[model samples]
Target: MPLFIRSVRLYPVNDNETFHRRFSVNVAVLGSLNLDVVFHCEALPIPGQTLLCDDFATGPGGKGLNQAVAARRAGAETSLLGAVGADASGDALLSFLKREDILTHGVVTLADAPTGVAHIVVDRDGENSIIVASGANRAVPADRLATAGLQALVWLAQLEMDIEVVGGFLREGRQAGARTILNAAPAIEAARSLFGDADLIIVNEHELAQFSGVPCPAGNDAAIEQAARKLMVRDDQILIVTLGAKGTQLVDSRSSFHVAAAPVVAVDTTGAGDCFCGVLAASLAQGASVPDAVRRANIAAGIAVGRTGAAPAMPLKDEIEAVSNG
Candidate 1:
């Protein structure tokens, strides 16, 4: 079956503000775009139980949006490719992106669906439980990717959208001489075959365990490296297993190393992983070495955890460097 691609240029209808930018797109992200509805609670409720919260907030989020914001704030020219509904939620998201100076030329509007949304509950510890209504995100046309001009750059992908498109984009981008980074969040079965196409695969401890069918090591770098290594089919492929608070470990064919997380008092851990991945992608796009980029990303994420929300909490390049240089 041939896929039909319908695209529209979403303008900043509600937001009447604009800023000038002097950079071109360096990183192109093809993933989910969502509006986040957040509830602040004492603790996450278990299944079959109900809890109430007093505080609530709504904002633009999703792995794609968060990463794109992180990349852009990290001083990389970034663009987003995803789908949204032709509704106010979608409009607000587009407007926010425009204000951030992110290129939205690839965001499609689905006339028949609502925009993707995430219902998130954050506890006092800054831990969260999320349930997503995929909506328009799942309906993205694979062919829409071709129009994004995603070649010859660092391409960012995630598991929030159609798996076929995720796999196809990685393959196409890599073949077009792009460095492909796959942030395998919400780890899925579809991601197994796509690893071959990714130059770098970023996953957390639990995701590593799920992918390798091994228990995530308890504070042991060797065990964590062993589990991460199982996912590497090629010698040159890199696997990054982000260990919360402890740091992130990078596994490659030749060797493995750990980048220590910067010391910080975390306030809200939401979007910390996305923060790391986005900053890493931006650093790499700017010609930073893998180790240096990872260090900067680690610091950026540490800074983000001290703040609140996802996209809004991302630190600018100056903020990250100030911490790095401090």
Candidate 2:
């Protein structure tokens, strides 16, 4: 059977000031928070080789933080449910989330651990390679998730935090009658066990390959569909495989289709995938059909890749509509 589908209109806002009260749908993100240290280079360094470029920046990131910000910017009543260090980095992250009007009540501070961090290298073509240091992110207590009041209509989960913790949230969220969406990033083998808990699963080509243990198709939609079919154990579960500039493939037991990517010049691809997942969850919470939500998310992610940074790069609902209408 197809998932629930409803028509949702875009919000009209002059600026970020109106995001909090503008949308009716509520969403909660359960994952990790990190400080991203980014470096730009002419080309990726070879072994024993060093290259330098002018751009260097640091900003708030991690799958959880980025997705929460993206959902909020896309006009959802968003809350971030995760842990941060008790130091300055955690304080700064909380301030940023509050400034965006996303609820920080679910975010906790841990005294014993340092904040998580990521070192990212962006090449001239907007391609990136990242290495993460899972600091305070790994310290998220399972009890915290159990205690948080996740009254939202939708709950989004990712792999940046402990996989078991994320699974627990997904199970609990489903029991509460809230729709659950899982974005399986960083390609962990354990994600395979949690697929049954999600009403929808969003992943890139690589993640799809990793989860299914099936080789990803190379530029062939038919082959991708075949591979996706092998991973669908339940009739209700929807699978979305993001194909970068090539767009995405949507798979369900009833039907499968492709959504084309929006045209845009690329600058940084750091959180483009995260932008897609966030907007999709927010759109679904507002009752959008799978195809409509995926189309809007494609546009939002295209806009994000044309800019830099993760959370800061996410496009608001109006921005997505502008490009979508044009």
Candidate 3:
């Protein structure tokens, strides 16, 4: 049985200032918030090798924060449900979310754990390698959803926090009649158990391969589709495989199709995937069909890759509209 059975209506927004007030759709994000330390280098160093080049910068990021920013910019009434430390870094992150117009009432502050951090290195080609310290992200209580007062049309999450917490959040969203989307990123084996709770699952090729126990070679559409099919838990469960420059592949019980990527010069692919997931959830909340939502998300991700940083790179509603309509 499908969890959600509400009437879908598309709401178009012409003004960014009043977009949230004009639309009834709401998207709640359950994930991690991190302070990102980015180092630019000509190329990533091999094991046991020492190399340094280019520049270093810092910003507010994390899958949760990035997606929340993306969703707000993409024109959804967005709220972030996560935890951060009661430190200056956490304060800055919360302020950043508020500045982006995303609701932060659901974001809790914990005094024990410091804010989470991600050490990222970006190569010249925009490819990145990241190491994360969970910190306050893991401190988010599983029961927080019960008291969050979220009236969401869509519930989106990632794997940056505890797997059990993510599962609990998705389960609650399902019971609440909101469409749940699980971005099984940084692919973990524990996330497989939560698949049954998700209405839609998004993953990269490597994640698809990991969860499906199949070889999903890059750019191999046939292989990717075969892998995606193995993970579909219900007749209506939709699976989206993000293939970087190759674009997005969507698989469901009824049918499967590919949405071509937007052509652009890649500068930094740090938050491209997060951009895609956030915009896709926002579009779905706005009542766009699966295919249309995927197309919009693909375009947004393409725009993100052309810029630097994660949360900052996400395209605005007007920018996405201009490119998508063009």
Candidate 4:
């Protein structure tokens, strides 16, 4: 039987928000929070070349912060579990998160560390290059993480944070019978094991090639499946390979399916992938099947690319429905 695809617009009435709230899966993001300073240029400059930028933008961005916000906007009862420096940026980040309704009870403050910061350069085509300083994000230790068995999902980004600590959460989350989801961005050597404990893994083309240990040539379906076949076994797990514009390839222990990308003239691709992960996780919490959830996530990401920054760029669930339902 074909997998049922739930309508991304399938949200219940306002009164139903309570049900979605009470019964909804709890999403806990164990990650980093950073301030992003973005520079928009008319094309990437070459080495030893000096070029003037056309625009500049700044937003709250970090794998940890972006994903957590994504989950919250996706309508999950989301919680942020991380650390930030007691600095000006941290103050602003908290204020923003509070407005989003994401619980920050677990976000610890470090006096010695500065808030993590990322300098991003977005080119004419909306592609970006980012340099990150982990700062206080690195200060979060295994001993500091608050234990929780009630969370339905625990998310982590390999923003140069310790993989062991993440693994421990997985081992513990399982003891609490929670789902473990990992977005292995900016690939790392230790990330190899992160997959073992996760129920889902989301990655882009470059990340897939490295993780699968194969030459994932830049192609459409064939290259995606060629790569997906190696990283995932049929039903053993699910792997989502994002193909910049061609859409996304989803592979699981059972099979792989391609969800075509929604058409949108992209301005900035920053935080789009993280947006996808957040929307996907939220849909799953709302009882969407994997394929259906991916469908919604694809639309959400498409909308994200059409905007600029990370937080301001993420559309509300209503906006996602409009795009997906279109």
Residues 33-69 of candidate 3: C-alpha lDDT, one tens digit per residue: 9999999998987899777876788898999999989
lDDT of candidate 2 over 57-175, digit per residue (tens): 99999999999988989888787888899899889888999999987766767779988999999998999989999888888778654223346789899988888898999998899
Q: Model 3 misses residue 306 by how many Å?
A: 0.8
Q: Pull out the clashing pairs in model 1.
A: none
For 1-326, candidate 4 gives per-residue lDDT tens digits of: 22322112232323423211222235777788889999989877778988787677767988878888887887777777778898999999999999998877667777899999998888889998888998988777776655443345444444356678777766676676666677777777577776777778788889988877876654566777777767653256788888877888887766777888878898999989888888887777677888998888889888899988987788788888887676
lDDT of 4: 0.76
What clash count goes with each model? 0, 0, 0, 5
Q: Each prediction's TM-score against the native?
A: 0.91, 0.90, 0.91, 0.87
Estimate every model's Cα lDDT from 0 to 1. Answer: 0.85, 0.84, 0.86, 0.76
Error of 3 at 110 (Å): 0.8
Give the lowest summed-lDDT range of ten residues in model 4: 1-10
Q: List model 1 lDDT by residue over 111-193, tens digit each.
A: 88899999988899888889999999988778654333343368889999988989888887787787999999889976898
In angstroms, give how far residue 97 of model 2 lies from its true place.
0.4
| Model 4 CA deviation exceeding 4 Å by range | 1-25, 153-160, 233-235
User: Sort by TM-score, best first: what order?
Assistant: 1, 3, 2, 4
Stretches off by above 4 angstroms in model 1 are: 1-24, 146-148
Model 4 CA RMSD to the hidden true structure, in angstroms: 7.7
